[model samples]
Target: MSLPLAIISYLILGESDTWFTTLGTYLYFILLPVFWVGYTVGKKILGIRIVNLDETDVSFWTMIKRQLIANIFYILTLGIGVIVSAFMVGIREDKRAIHDFIAGTYVTFHPPWQK
Candidate 1:
């Protein structure tokens, strides 16, 4: 995903622009909401889904909040956020990332038969 954006930036803005990297960083923020919605929607289609820590359906606002926090940490950390995010998931009792924690959400395995 970032690859295409990088390529596009290079093509349009010239490879020499330092702002390309900044634009790529901003692009991440732009993609977060779209990504979360797509991820949740896809999970629903697959009969597995994400919910809140309380096992309630994830709200759009919550998803946005989660994405915002996670993205901020990601941008600030200069890509180390992936590792931190993954570690957050591993350490969480319910297996949630920092985004999930901020959003009060959890991903759970749901069998297709039950859906």
Candidate 2:
């Protein structure tokens, strides 16, 4: 999604700093997951999705917390948090990463229940 937009942006604007690129990045990485059953394009392709632990739909704020707030910890820890998160997901019984705990969410292979 961003790739085509980036190519076009570069062609037209001669740089990737345009609003189109920013919008494409945010739409694909953030908003899409909030509205698209919690699955981004890659996650959907991988047959997994994020879900709230309470079995509710993942809200916009929750997605923000997951995507933005949790990332702060990852950055502040000099990326150790990210490494720990990967280990936790691999070794923990619940298979949850730090972001999942912070956002009260989990990734699951089970498809969301249709209305």
Candidate 3:
């Protein structure tokens, strides 16, 4: 959802291929806050949340770093990053991916009202 929005935004802005690489960077800033607030807006909507490896709420800086790392991988690979990210999450003890590891965070399911 967020990815599409970003692409659409770029298209609307008439960005060229050369500027494509920068889109991920822009999206990082755009999404970082959303991710930091409660793991992710999507996760929040889905009744899930992310915490740190230490079992505390994830910090804003951590989310920013995670977004930076994940978006870099995402841009480098055409779209393979998603698959890699999924596998990493699936294999992680706390259901975290490369981004989470870089940020020292863990994702977990939560009840809606609790959010």
Best by TM-score: 2
Flag the better candidate by lDDT, 1 or 2: 2
The positional error of residue 24 in candidate 1, measured at the CA in angstroms, is 15
Which tens-of-lDDT digit does each residue in 25-70 have in candidate 2?
Answer: 7667678878898898889999988889976778898888887889
Worst 10 residues of 1 by lDDT: 32-41
Off by over 4 Å in 2: 1-5, 16-23
Q: What is the lDDT of residue 111 in candidate 1?
A: 36
Q: Is candidate 1 or candidate 2 better by TM-score?
A: 2
Of the candidates numbered 2 and 3, which has the greater lDDT value?
2
Task: Put down candidate 1 lDDT per residue, 28-59, tens digits, no spaces.
Answer: 54354345532443465675566666655555
TM-scores of all models? 0.54, 0.81, 0.58
Ranking by TM-score: 2, 3, 1
For lDDT, the strongest prediction is 2
What would the per-residue lDDT of candidate 3 be over residues 13-94, giving only the tens digit for each residue?
A: 7653335446554555446544565544566677676666656666667667777676787778887877888987778666
Cα deviation at 8, candidate 2, in Å, is 3.9
Stretches > 4 Å off in candidate 3: 1-36, 73-82, 111-115
Cα lDDT, model 3, residue 30: 44
